[model samples]
Target: MKQNRLIQNIILLIGCLLLNSCYQNEEYMQTVQQNHLLIDIKDSGIYSNEPISRANTVGYTTTFSEGDKIGLYAVKNGEILPDVNNVCLSYTEGKWVANSSISYSEDKVGAIYYAYYPYDQALSTFNKTSTDPFEALVSSWEIGNDLTGDIYTGKDLMTGFANAKLEGRNYTLDLTLGHRMSLAVIKLPTTTYNFTNAGMSSYNVSPQNISFTIGKDSESEAPILPYYDITSDTYRILIHPNTAYTLKGKFTNGANANKSYTINIGTDIDKAQYAQYIVDQPEIINYTLNIGDYYCADGSLVSKDGPAPSNCIGVVYQVGTTDAIKNDYPSCNHGLVYALKRVEGDPIKWSTSKPSSTNWYEKYGMLLYNATGVDIQGYEETKTWMDIETGEVEGVDINSIMKSTLNDYRQNFILPSTTTDWYLPSYKELDALNNNATILNTQFSKVNGEALWTSATKDISYWSTTIRRQDAVVQYHPDNKTKAGYIRDSSGYYRYSFGF
Candidate 1:
């Protein structure tokens, strides 16, 4: 009986060895050398293969820190493996480690792989957007405010997957996560001086589609407000691919309070993967201002050739008011008003004059003063300099001249002014004047006013009301992208402007 038992044991051992040999002949069979999976995380925005620091990644994706989670799915033979479904991994130090690593078992080998960031335990399965292009539905992910929340992760959605053939013992995947969303960086105009604070008046969004243009499904839209970044003074929205949106802007201060702008972001919006909407002045106000209107000192505009209002100081030679400025001074007809003449007559030698030599020009070596915090748009800046602390500032002098010396403007400047006060124009104001010099000059001649641009301000730059830290930014006539505007000038003409 003992001999018979020994013979059966030998037969069983031989059968087990022969079974292992048969398994080796299969494609998924592996040599004993390799067993673990090797995965690498990458940002497809920067699009790199060789390992690089996270800083090199682009757009909202920062360097990965410890504890960041990743979920993976390994599918084989048209179905996901039971054990490897939604496997969670964590980033530690500089490597991604798994809770229980997927082994190079025959079942796990020769399989397709899919990976997603911010692993959620509840997400058992996710739908694919398309099969041919291998797109995964990122719609399930909700976009949070990047400014208020974790700026790097929640706002952006990323995915990594592989659908190609796999036949190796050890599974290796370069899981480069690609962005499936778009960015809309909406910037308010700098001249939106009236915007003490910002708010969204209207926001609407439609479901994302594979095509660039979304269907007319207004009833199925969602309300999504773009994240407003106070630091940059801009609005940012993280949008799913080909998602249509509509944004209307309103500001806190009076002008923007009364007025609002609606922008329909539809087919015109660039909807490519990882694409960005343009940063531009989408649309200005819906009003127009004719050049050569009589400008009252109180910041009001009278029709061309009409009787000047009480305290009329000049005529409207330029209509370059920004949307924000238009919001502030509607009485000015959303245009710029230049005085009939410059201050202290001809351009002085800057400092030798009483205004220049005063503490205003106390900054050494430089011609302009170091007057700080003078960026107010309308009456505020003039009030600070003229302090109309008077004798020292031109605002007082200009007011006196308009009321007394300039006979025609004296009553016009005094007519219960809508703008209420006048001051030297800011840098932006001056540029607005210079930009339309041609149209302004023609109107000025017809209205019998000083030539908007004379030989005095042509070759050299004029002193702009905008002065900062010994530097004066003037309107240079280079007219090219390199030198369109924003140049400093030592020579200047102190000219007063109506309203702002």
Candidate 2:
């Protein structure tokens, strides 16, 4: 029995060896398929059919690398396989391709591969109708919208798509990438100034340090952008493709480093369509901001012609008045009186309208120096004396005080008589001026040939006759609602005043 068992074991061992040999031979006979994927990138501006290289990467310095996310899908046996979504493409030497799990298979000669760069969604599982196959997952920082926030910077949304069927073990796919953002390569004109001029000169501008911003009007927040200064007069900035943007450009001048050189670049550009627009009419979008476009605060320009600079206070509103100036205005039929242009600087700190600081006394008529010690910190209801008809302090004749101060200031300046009686507008009145700023600016532009307000000229201290205590009312332009406008100390000489 032992001999018979040994014989059977030897036969079993031989049979196992033969079967393993046959299996090995079968595997060796099967062919290994090798395939390749090719890529091409194109710009919307230059749609040259060229493959993207390191030199042509629009917003980035380097191309896809190891662990770079990409979307891929395969079709085998005429049926789409499981999508290899967001798989990192491996970088070998210079080329990038998906790993074996996504592209390699012995019988995958007929397979088709689809790939996209900067992958965010699973291209393989993309819904044909509802999903956008070419969209990238861009962040806000990447968009880098111009100051107005409506225009997108073109540098961030780089998208590409490629598809090719594998054949004969190896195949090359040709993909193309195109820009979705509009292109604005502006060439700023050389600013030539009359040397005889005494104001700002374009020669002082630092070309490389210039800033360009674009967006909608409501987008006041400016985004920092990388700009290329191709030449002293040329600049390039990337912007979003499909939206309109309001543009603002600024640079520092060596002559007036304390001041900013500013220009409004107009707001009709639709960045998405910029490329085509340029293609159609190259001169249409190729703008050149002239040196003369810069805003100046010179008072002489006030009566010249054009819109007022934002720094200047515009009209408050139109009110019926018999002031002689209204008779010459375009709206003479309405007896309209324009508010005084807002000025900068601190004016008089002392006012006769205020009561004496040391006495803290309430009087019907008392002259006082720039008084202090009025505390209205928590007095919400006592904000204005408009409603108080009884108190001598709150109900003091505001018109009389206005008439005297306006005449005094005019005489001091030795200027011509103003159109209307000038007086410190009440708090509510000033607030109204701020709220109706748009209308005020428009009407002033129409009536006055040139209107510009001097901003923060001398930190002018203005006196408000409306007093709460020993403290007379005072206002500083660009001052906020809660503080900075109220004056308590009045020991110094008055330097500035306000009127409406």
Candidate 3:
């Protein structure tokens, strides 16, 4: 009886062992079926400029049944290998569309899952295990609020979607998913201001425009707005939230006069007050004058005490009279005369001895008398004493000689004849010569008894070169004509040519 009992006990033990093996196998199969393999799908947009990584999760789920495990494994195409002892099932809402070129298949489940996947739980896991804090941030997401209908078991979500789910939890992804992102572009208010220096004006501003990014994420950084610098004379305004910004003011003064301007930003600026302020800080105006040292009308160098011509030296020649003795004193009887005269010294000198009665004037006494004689007839009688003696007797035309001598001096000595070979005096030159003669006569007693002719010829109305329109004393002068002055005469002179 004892032997039989031992044998039965051994057989029972063997049967128990086999039954336990069978149950364990069935339980393993059931576990595999219930728990689906959790894979985090990271949607990186269909058309992306940057590369995206696959989604990864940490801390596997412990509440999975044996059959659940089978379900998880069945979804995987290749052999389902769980890294952690505790398996979990999580979904991801990938950025994939219906017409996406992604190739995907499932080995176990028949349920057609759209591009949607659980992203919240996956993000949580990713955050827990990721070395970078920003790794869990969904770089690509869905657009609509409802992601369930668009998600698939093996596909990703559509591109440009802003919302998604992770591990069965809804999460709003703050990711730069699209190829292009739109920012709320706000134009900042511009303030204009003006500045002037040396009769020049310019306008400028401080800031140009303001720009910011608008979205549903807290991690998003504001866009970089342009800035203005006073030193660089460039301005940029970036309109932002919750901040009072000022635009640098600028202005342009057309006349280039020194003036101050205020820059007002909003509609609340006080124009009167600003104007007062500008007035108080008035800019100093600077003017330039074209003037030189004062001198006598005789062209002699002088100091401040020296008399200044009523008009500019340039215009004085236009209305002045000719003086006969201007070139050679005590001898020649031809020169420019001035209406306004100035003596060299304080005391005026007069002589009791007559010019011809003086002993020093004996040799030229007869010549002078003959030249001044009024009974001379024709050109022969007008000849000078020197000309008659030398057998080169020519008509001593005083007016002709004056014009020729003036032209010769101007063309040779007064001007740079080498560079400018043909800068002859114009008709205006004659007018200037006549005016110069008048000034000489009035200023000096040496310019007596001379006849100076002007280049102006008489037309049907009046002098050809006379100014007609303007009547002011400043305007009547011929020297003011915007051209070169010239002289003319009916007599011929010895002309010399320089060898080139």
Candidate 4:
């Protein structure tokens, strides 16, 4: 009876074990069929010009650059899962792996998820993790708010949401990261000039740096450091998505000056990008003079239209479009005549002496530049200010000969005016003055000034800087507007005109 009892107990125990194993198998099968959550993540956008890594530095990317990270939030049963709140889903190995596991209970209707790139630490403690799909339409982003993180180091804020799609027993949530922010690429116009050659430290005429304001700018301050791409010569600035902004930066001349400008980036910057080419030109032509204005002794123009100032040296009579008067005035487009009033004593001759080394001035009649033809207009007009400045009569420029005491032009320093700044006016420039002689003479009278040409009939003529090699020196007196020149050795008064 004892043996039979032992055998029965062993069989009962074996049956219990077999039953338990069968139950475990049933449980495993049930677990396999249970609904679980899964996600397939991707980025959706165009390729960017500023590449930070595998993804664009400006954050407009359509593919994941390995090692990219994003915050994942899951919602089930109309409530955001506590464990999935701003949970970091880092791209690892070959897949996105979550630090903490999250699964939807079978009782929940469907799983919803919101994911965004460039996870921020501040978002973890935020209490409001609402499950609304439109939660993105309005932002509570202070600097890098919500789970959006507003901006990455040099990237746009990418956010996207999707409803879970069911695949048999698994709920797969697909999140495609996208963003709406202005990607500003500021570039200065390519200039051929080397600014450093002209005493400048750094001559790239570009904005120092760019900063942006979200909303009204009065609401909050969000300044971003721009990424400069030297290869492309571009500066990239990322603005907060969907917010009104004003991008600001001071345009500068190397390290010299600051030029301020305000550009409104209202809703227009939504998901768009632009390349602003700053129109900057280094100064080579400075225009400050106009006809009928007081030309200062120092070659500066008086602001007003009429009357001469106490420092007046000459009156402006002509402007550009005339090469006859063009000279070494590096900062001006116009020039002034020297000593508005002529000779301290009385009118003098063109010269009392000539160079002793040679009688070339006597034989050529002092007009060496127009040696070949004096009758033909083009041939006779071959002379320019450069010829007199460069041509030397016995190793002496014509200007030095004129500045000599033997000539009528004074060498003494005229108060408020430097006689050195003066140059004898050419025939074309003298003609230009002749055209406006009446007005100039009128101004001279008003300023207690004396002018060379008082009128057309004033037999009182002034010496000119022009000379024909075959003829005598030219005179300021003109017989007609069309004549090439008039050469007369008759003693004449003298005045000098200066190029600004």
Tell me the tens digit of each residue's lDDT in model 2 across 281-356.
Answer: 1111121222112122211112113444442322323233222223333222111123334322334333234333
Candidate 2 least-lDDT 10 residues: 276-285
Predicted candidate 4 versus true structure: per-residue lDDT over 1-500, tens digit per residue: 99999999999999999999999998886566455567678666533433343254433344555666788766776667677788888778767877777666654455567787667646643323464453453254333421123234325556778887777656677888766454556554331212222321221223333343323455654444565655666665655544566655554332223455555655444453432434355422222445666655433345335445665667766543233323332333333443476555555443323333434554433344345533211111323332443235444344333345323343463423212245556555667777776677777766777764545436655556555332345655655332322232345555665544
lDDT of 1 by residue, 270-303 (tens): 2223223333342322223466666543333456
Question: Which stretches of model 4 miss by more than 4 angstroms?
Answer: 1-38, 46-59, 62-68, 120-138, 143-155, 166-171, 193-216, 219-224, 229-233, 241-244, 251-261, 271-500
Runs in model 2 lying further than 4 Å from the true structure: 1-70, 73-80, 90-92, 104-114, 120-131, 135-142, 145-155, 166-169, 189-209, 229-235, 253-500
What are the models' TM-scores? 0.38, 0.34, 0.17, 0.37
Residue 390 accuracy (lDDT) in model 2: 30
State which candidate has the highest TM-score: 1
The local distance difference test score of model 1 is: 0.49
lDDT of each: 0.49, 0.38, 0.25, 0.51
Q: In lDDT terms, which candidate is top?
A: 4
Candidate 2: residue 392 lDDT (0-100): 49
Q: Is candidate 1 or candidate 4 better by TM-score?
A: 1
Per-prediction backbone clash count: 12, 30, 100, 6
For candidate 3, give the lDDT of residue 232: 30
